[model samples]
Target: MRVLGVDPGLTRCGVGVVEGTPGRPCTLVAVGVIRTDPDAPLPDRLLRLDTKLTEYIARFAPDAVAVERVFSQHNVASVIGTAQASGVAILAGARADVAVHTYTPSEVKAAITGSGTADKKQMTSMVTRLLRLEVAPKPADAADALALAICHVWRGGTQARIAAARTRVEEKGTRT
Candidate 1:
């Protein structure tokens, strides 16, 4: 499966695409950041994000999109912007008719580094090693995005199975 992972932020949204399945070595298809000037108006920044994300969806044609779930932050403004950025990613995936899933930061970190409390350096090192890249992706965001993609590729099947089991339970009129 081809998965597009989005680490969304108003200032620097990270995007990465990977193709693989559970137990298979994943290939890095693409990785980059989408930057919007802090001075730019909110609408303009969102528009830029929308346009670039649409282009990515069209180009990569991913089977699924894995977005980082926005968690509340101390800075309300930052949290709001991140939630908005995440919405853009979900919208783009919907428009492309691709499944969109959200993973918490801890979930992503644990999937990549075997520990939810892994630091950025550890996460970066693991991502570099997993992708077999000569060096870690820069700016942290890029590496985080790739890590998100790897998480989805590695965990998606199990997640899907769990969801299916829940659905079956619900159909049988059992409380979950």
Candidate 2:
């Protein structure tokens, strides 16, 4: 499956694309950040983000989108910006008719580094090793986005299959 992972931020939204199946290595398709001027109006920033995200969706044609779930932070303004960016990401996936999944920071860290408390350096190292990249993706945000994709490929695939099985069983019972 091809997956697009987003590390949503108002100023620098990171995006990564990978193709793989469960229990296998994933190949990196692309990695980059969408930058918006901090001075730009909020509405314009969001629109710019949406446009970039839409282009990515069309270019990559991902089977699913994985986004970092927004968590409470000391700065309410930062959290709000993140949440809004995340909403745009979710909307991009929905508009493209792809399944969207959100994973908390700890969930992604655990999946990538075997510890929920893994630091950015550890996460970056793990993501580099997992993807077999010669060099780490830059700007922590880019690495985080790749980590999110890897996590989804490893965990979300199984979850989706189980959900599908349950749906099939329900349909069978209804038919009966």
Candidate 3:
């Protein structure tokens, strides 16, 4: 399955695309950062993010979009900006008729590095190894986006199967 992962931020939103399935090695389809000027008006920044996210969704044609869930932070401004960017990304996925899933920072870290408390350095190292990249994706954000994608591919695929099985069982019961 193809998954697009987004690490949303006002200044620099990370985007990564990966294609893989559970118990299989994933291939990196693309990775980049969407940058918006901090000085730009809030509406303008959101517009920029929306445009880039829509383009990425169209270009990648992902089966699903995985976004970093916004969490509380000491800096209210930072949290607001991130939540806004995340909203735009989620909207883009919805526009494209793609399912958008949100994962907490701890969930993503655990999925990629096997530790909920893994630091950025550890997550980056694991992402590098998982993708078999010679060098880590730069700007931490980029690596994080890739990690989110990898996490979705690994976990989301299994979740889909479980849901499908439950649906089948429900249908069978209804017929009986």
Candidate 4:
């Protein structure tokens, strides 16, 4: 499966695409950051982010989009911006008729590094190793985006199968 992972921020939203299945090596399709002017108006910034995310969804044609879920932060303003960006990312996937999943930061870290408390350095190192890249992706945001994609590629399939099974069971129960 191909997945597009989004680490959303108002200024520098990270985007990455990875292709693979569970328990297998994943290939990096693309990785980059979408930058918007911090000084730009809120509406303009959101529109820019939305447009870029939509373009990525079209270009990559990912089977799913894994977005970093916005969590409460000390800075309310920061959290608001991130939450808005996250919504735009999700909307992009929905507009393209692609399945969208949101994973928490801790969940991603654990999936990529086997520890929810792994630091940025460790996460970057693991992402580099897992992708078999000679060098780590530049900027913490970029690396984080790749890590998100890798996490989803490693876990999303199994989770999807489980959900499908549950739905099937529910349907059968209702019919019976």
Considering every candidate listed, which one attains the maximal TM-score?
3
lDDT, candidate 3, 90-159, per-residue tens: 9999999999999999999989888999999999999999998999998888999999999999999889
Q: For residues 43-124, could you state the per-residue lDDT of candidate 2 as single tens digits?
A: 9999999999999999999998999998786268698999999999999999999999999999999998899999999999
TM-score of 1: 0.89
RMSD to the hidden true structure, all candidates: 3.4, 2.0, 1.3, 2.2
Error of 1 at 1 (Å): 0.6
lDDT of 4 by residue, 24-117 (tens): 8888899999999998899999999999999998888999999999978636869888888998999989989999999999999999989999
- By summed lDDT, which 10 consecutive residues of candidate 3 come out lowest? 71-80
Q: Give each model's whole-structure lDDT.
A: 0.91, 0.94, 0.92, 0.91
Q: Give the clashing residue pairs of candidate 3, or none.
A: none
lDDT, candidate 2, residue 134?
99
Model 4 alpha-carbon drift over 4 Å, by segment: 163-176
What's the true lDDT of residue 36 in model 4? 99
How would you order the candidates by TM-score, starting with the best? 3, 2, 4, 1
> What lDDT does candidate 3 reach at residue 126?
91
**TM-score of every model versus the real structure:** 0.89, 0.92, 0.95, 0.91
Q: How many residue pairs clash (N, CA or C atoms closer than 3 angstroms) in each of the candidate models, in the order given?
A: 0, 0, 0, 0
Question: Poorest 10 consecutive residues of model 4 by lDDT?
Answer: 71-80
Clashing pairs in 4: none
Residue pairs with backbone atoms closer than 3 Å in model 1 (clashes): none
Candidate 1 residue-wise lDDT, 1-176, digit = tens: 99999999999999999998786778899999999999999999999999999999999999999999987853686898999999998999998899999999999988988899999999989888888888788879888888888899889977888899999989889653
lDDT of 2 at 88: 98
